[model samples]
Target: MSDPAPRIVRRETHSPRSTAAVIVALCLAVVIAWVATEGVLSLLGLPALLLSPRGMLTSVAGAPDASAASVIAVAVAAGLVGVVLLAIALLPGRRARRPLHAEHAIVVADDTMLASALARTAARTAAVSADAVSVSLGRRTATVRIVPVSGTRVDRDAVRGAVTEEFTRAAPTRPARVSVLVSPAGKVGS
Candidate 1:
């Protein structure tokens, strides 16, 4: 009997590559179109709407005669822009995403949902109201903020344990360190 084919799992997080590339492509297209329009107008012996290609070349050729400070500033600006684009192209852009491992398939959960779940788990474990707990999940850490009710003490260690357990149950590929923060000021009446 033939063995089953291996399944390929796609674990890519959100990246700005497509958006950046599209924006750069559109900008280049606009410049090329403008130059083509100017060339065609010159050929037809019509009045140029803007500077002609020859005029642009002449200005560029005479740019060295301009003030040294202005030329240096322009060159530095262009170099900085080039470096930024190169960094964007080479660096891997990663976003915060929660993925739950399942037997049959992986379920992707929204960041807000993950945060809410962690908050709820911590609140329930700490014997507090839902509104008393808040969670913020980052790339490598999940911070659980708790505002205790007046005259009540919240166990930070307990809350941290519960939140950590719940997060571990989710089984994300990239695990985050769970941290519980108890507010110094307690809320009134709740």
Candidate 2:
């Protein structure tokens, strides 16, 4: 056996400093922008709010002489309406984000659909078959994984199209990512 060179681990070699700097700068920029915006808005609103309290109301008649009972009644009514609307908005959003009982999420999706779709698309493009397909559901997102069935060819474009077509019809919302795992051919167990 021949001697092999020692493997050098360079974690940052695969990534660039420019990309890291850009991402950091982007996050810092967003934070600074939000802070500046909030500061400016608060400063501008303070004068109108404190210097001229009467200006806060549309009508001068309702400012000083409004009875406490009327104010309480209005506050209660407003709170009730707000709570109802908030519940209506939040419940549906939460429900939509989660599968209706985890077991029922992928009723129609199966190993056959994914395998056949990838195989058919591969055959049409003269590409190699994908070994297996796995589907995952997340918060308002679904992901489909395609692993190469053989070493012949992995047509990423065709795979993406096939995966999108299948998910578009079945999933409730758009998928977040589709990853194609390239491995040695005939490794179906993997």
Scored by lDDT, the top model is 1
Candidate 1 per-residue lDDT, tens place, 1-190, comes to: 5432222223335555888999999999999999999999989988787998789899899998989999999999999989999999998676666567777765767778889999999999878899999899887799999888877888889888888888888855667798888888889987
lDDT of 2: 0.48
Could you estimate the TM-score for every candidate?
0.87, 0.29
lDDT of 2 by residue, 54-88 (tens): 44343456645788888789889979977875664
Error of 2 at 78 (Å): 32
Candidate 1, which segments miss by more than 4 Å at Cα?
1-12
lDDT of each: 0.83, 0.48
Question: What CA root-mean-square deviation does each model show from the true structure?
Answer: 3.1, 18.0
Q: What lDDT score is found at residue 69 in candidate 1? A: 97
Cα-based lDDT at residue 104, candidate 2: 28
For model 2, the superposed segments whose C-alpha errors exceed 4 Å read: 1-131, 172-177, 184-190
